[model samples]
Target chain A: MASVLPRTVQGPPVPLRWPPEDNRIPREIFTDPDLFRWEMDAVFTGPVWVLVGHEAEIPQPGDYKTLSVGAVPVIVVRGADGQVRVLVNACAHRGARVVEGPRGNVLKGGFRCIYHMWTYAPDGSLLGVSLPDDFPVEFRKEDYGLPRARVALYKGLIFASFHEQTPPLEEYLAELTQGMDRVLGDGRLRYLGSIKVIFRTNWKLYVENIYDGYHVTALHTGFQVVRLRSHGGQRLVPNYERNGHLWGQSRSTRREELQPVLRDMSLFDVRTKPTTDHNMMVVFPSGVVTDYFDTIQLRYVLPLAVDQTLIEFTFFARADDPEDVVRHRVRQGPAVLGPAGAITLEDAAALERVQQSSVARGDNVILKGTPKRFPPYRHVDEAPIRHFYQAYRRLIGVPVEEGTP
Target chain B: MNNADDLSVREQAARELLARYVRVVDDPDRVEEWPDLFADQAEYRVVTRENLEAGLPISVVCDDTKDRIMDRVTVIREFWGAGGRLEDRHYNQVRPRHVVGPVWTEPQEDGTVRVVANFVVWGTPTTDPAPRLLALGEYRDVVEFTARGPRFRSKWVVLDTPVLQDVFVYPL
Candidate 1:
């Protein structure tokens, strides 16, 4: 018999009280500041792919959007050559931030650092610096260009990684691509807009909440009031033992069958897709892609601190959509999915309460559909959350027991 | 009454309508009174300054018609379990308070008056100790002197900051 090789990760010992049963997660991890900082290094900057933006967001050359990758602020800009580059927002000269607003086109003048007027091209190559003649003997503009992350595109979705050893985008996504394709269609999407909100909870709670299907009908009373239930579907964890990405697929009740709760029932209508089947997927660490009803949304989870997370809900429409269809999407997208949406504020309420009580010190147990400790759970199961933590444990240097998977 | 006094009276009514709006939304018990402040065919939308300036059509809340405006109350009171239903109490009970200042009323070429004011809202959760700043924005409102009273023709809440600190249960 051949022996399995043991993987090792290095970090400071977390104040975690993990139990023998893999389902019980200690509350300390949510509140520990040291662990949060360590995660920025071990999990984010470690070998992992983080979704930054979609190609439709910056379709034109010199168009750019700014966001943070883990703790590092980055600019996701489309170069004049039609390639997307995730450059660090800081200037090479004194490290002053280059980009100011949320998004804009730099085609006119490129990114200029206001501190000393050091400027760079759309592709992040240093174009000029003020008073460079009085510099050192080895002064080279090529060497002083803003640092950037390795970028990969799966369809139109853009993913960025700081680590050199991160796997290829296809291998990283695994079987989740099928679900993404089902939602993305031909990948020709039009960017409508985005609503950025701060959730008063850890980033893990926000991501895990998406994996937890058990709370849907319970916490969100709107779902219950509409009498909408999943017809038939299952929860899938691709590469469960390794990455533990969640693909929650389900076919929902038709709009005609739903109860008339709202005066405008258009919020529940699904006109774009052929069937009522929808996907809510978490791409490993912190990328949420879902096509709930006719609304297509992508959530970027940015951890601001141990207790706070910034979630930008970016909505989209198919490039070939008609005017009425676009209007329906605009009216329905934020009404149901955005921060203050009818069904969405309940999550913020629930998650904030959870973060409040995490200081009480105990294990938050997972009971719903944890009979055998693996994937292939029901559509209304919370068991896939365990796999999420398992991948998290591997990255954070916590050892899994022998034959755990 | 003199022409100057009549003009001042009309402005007072417009300002009073604005005052009544802040009073209704700030009280948790008076959420039902919110939609009534609008005209029969009014539009209400809450959009971030970034998206608004960029000409993005998406909004955090887009109640463009009277039916949708009335439905916002239904969503808060009945759907969200905020109507004192203990069995299905999912949403947190927060006391909303709004601060309005530097009001401006511009009479358009037509009879409608445009009211602009800088406002900030604070939410104090029933369970938590600290009060959270929900949103700070400028309200670009159009007030029509209807037969009933000065009702809002349209109210656009333009947020000063793009990042909302937390989800707001009531209208801002």
Candidate 2:
């Protein structure tokens, strides 16, 4: 339970109590600078795992990619010792980012800070200081190693946590990783590519949209028209399993109609069914792995500000996938996954409007088989949203009251 | 034994044909000409320079088949127009997707012409008075002489920038 903070005697900005009992979220959560800082401290940089990249992305020893966990810049690198490490990108001396661009290979002497020529090993150990001989007598070289977060991996997707008390990735994911297993069957994911874009909305808003199953048909009507008309709905099932994890299994029927010259032959694994197997799994905080109609991918999100979020729709082709099949999968992934993706394109418009309109006084109600009333959920049910809000409330240190936003 | 007049006539004809094609592709009012610009089995892909250089398969806009290109038109008219977010662009309500200037054309050998053009697709939201550049990319094209005169054998829109402001509801 979240400990209640003092009310009415506030000098600082926290959550408000106006209408206090409704699931109608206060607009401040999406726009306030104070709330963003608090969430960075209490939720993102706190006891939570941030999904960054995959082991294959940095297959070489010196290969590295820069990413962000919350607002903290991170460098996911494979060290010379064959270990994947997540080092803070800030230079130990001047706080300048170590890894400059998105990613590159620095095999020889770790990362070198262009600002002051402070070099660090691939494993984040301090290596050289150009003006080292003139520092304080008590300045020890060993104490200046790059700060690192705890790195972990499930299958091939890499994740890291800032806090030491954060539970292991297995425990943090709970039984949710079981669903992830199906998506990453055998875990031999070949890096296809990624389309990176920033959403002009809060990162939390984008994460919540992942679990908002209700918006599938209404918001993305064109896609729904295609899917429902093409594939006879094989019953959309939502897995609101505990721990803020969500899994959805829905089969598409339009396989034969839209079959290209090279179709998806379930090149992934024997466990993956062709048209009948469609699943989307969202890990807590901001990682989404979706296996839609034989095209598998992950959506990694990073928060930049209260009203901005950077996201990457990284599509993959299995290592053993046939050449033509890989081409087909590539065509399929971006068609419906990223900024220029299928239904996602329309979704961006609606989501931006939601953020833009959150400045006014309003309370949005969640009902109609929402999480508060599950057990008899339908394809059109909003139950997953309730599950998200419950998890969000707990994570954001907001008191959990039934039927409250 | 090469005649300057013959070469001048050929170059003028090629440039004129390319100029006509650019007008049809660039004008929002003449977007209906998109279908006629492609051959029966043509490929038009709007991709990033990075993907193109790497020989990657994915694209921002991939319309390999003639049907997919037609689907883009039908989908835009039927789906995007019916009453969704695109309607919210109050600044220029007629059609938000259009190409800008700098349509450069170069004549190539064997009845082919290489073409290049830069464009910015804007999404003028009703909330803001100014129109936002949704995507800025150059059209890398290879036009050839087909049965139906000059047509787009393939057009690859190589977007210089990585970010596309919001949605790509229309042609790049």
Candidate 3:
């Protein structure tokens, strides 16, 4: 059956112009299936810490959530011992998916795979298997337990890495933690719920769109209607030499000062902060954290295919927030950032058009804040996108020009 | 009329309201009429089946009040540049076609009607030839008769597809 199948193509679809210019990106990266497959191996599974979920999501014992690390499905579960484990969802017996749902609690009987009634504990330890006498004598249940990634926690944010060479969470995060700390605010959050939407664009295009600051007022007309301009801020590429994580800090016009577009002005009201300062961050590859207005949102980007991506916009509020405040956060979070959000729907419209046109085959050049090809770019500049591709090319083993920055 | 006959008459009125709603939403030019379908005090929300079953309060779109519901119309036309507004046309112009059927209506004791129906919306963007499936959901609604006509007291769109395939420009 395999011999009759068409030969698989390796490497990029089109020959990459070697040692790419800092501001120019090859359009082929967004449309190539072969390159996307290679990225799953080199970038996602390689020495990289991917943000899976926050501790607040699965707070109770035996509470579990299913997410993917690149293309590999894994379960982020809280054990009875109060430990959060990231375990592969596939069963060891016949390679069946142990868990099926997005989230649930398994405190009662643990994860019992209906495929063969193989039961595993909350900690992913194999408890029992149906009719085990038929198995080989050398088969040890201990060795057959689900494979788990090296887990790390930073202010209740859970990160998992399959590669042993992945750096410490703090080191990988670096200066990005300052912005995260400002947004997290002591790291005690209550999970409200998440709205997942599929963006018709490459995963990189979706992630890099956050790093871009130039598109705020141009593409999103909602910003223009309210006359909200960045008062003062800078787009920071923390660990630009290695990680190229984006930490875009900005203070926009206050709600009262903005043009009254909506009757319910609570959408743009920033009551929690003394100023209208907010933080928007991308944790290297696929995690998006933002504190825009009173909304605390974390977006997990999962690539479905070369031109398709799944973005789960998870919202949160302070655990100690009053009832009204929690309600405010809940109402404000998705309305501004989710799929039907006032400012968010435009990005989907724009990125999908870009994805559809990438087959035209040309270099998409970065012009904003690219004169010097280095840091100190304006808050409204899209220069940080260059560093993003730099880090991406490094992981994909594409030779970037020396001193490109 | 007898009890059975009266109930059927109420259900028929509720069914007409549902049919009118799909027609109004399907036409992009008639978006302003969307809010008029609801009562003066109403709640409109779009939530996923997974989240709703888990007892989560968050939703994709939570217009919990009539004011908020009206505000959505403003956001769609003015902010999203749908109604020939003087702003950058953000959303691509798409013709929304709702395939709704197998509706059930029950007359309530409080003089309101409980309505339920399964619906799937197909979006044909002006730019693309292919029409995409925008949403697949069940509408759990409540209707109240007023001096003008029957209006929706509550409209809850429960999505069967947990992962939305695309961003909807208008209401489902």
Chain A TM-scores in order:
0.96, 0.87, 0.95
Ranking of all candidate structures by their TM-score, best first: 1, 3, 2
- Colliding pairs, model 2: A22-A405, A23-A404, A23-A405, A231-A253, A335-A342, A336-A342, A370-A383, A371-A383
- The TM-score of candidate 2 is 0.87
Which lDDT tens digits does candidate 3 get at residues A257-339? 99887888899989888899999999988888899999998989999999999999999999999999999998998999999
Candidate 3 off by > 4 Å: A1-15, B1-6, B82-90
iRMS of each prediction: 1.9, 5.1, 2.0
Instruction: Put down candidate 2 lDDT per residue, A194-287, tens digits, no spaces.
Output: 7777688888778777666677777665554344432322212233333466666565545444323222222222233544556677777788
Regions of candidate 1 where Cα sits further than 4 Å from its true position? A1-9, A13-16, B1-7, B82-92
Clashing pairs in 1: none
In angstroms, how far off is B66's CA in candidate 2? 3.2
Native-referenced DockQ of model 2: 0.35
- State which candidate, 1 or 3, has the greater DockQ: 1
In terms of docking quality, model 3 is medium
Q: What's the residue-level lDDT of A140 in candidate 3?
A: 90
Per-residue C-alpha lDDT of model 2 across residues B52-95, encoded as one tens digit per residue = 66555667777777766766664564444434454543221424
Against the unseen true structure, what C-alpha lDDT does each candidate score? Answer: 0.88, 0.67, 0.87
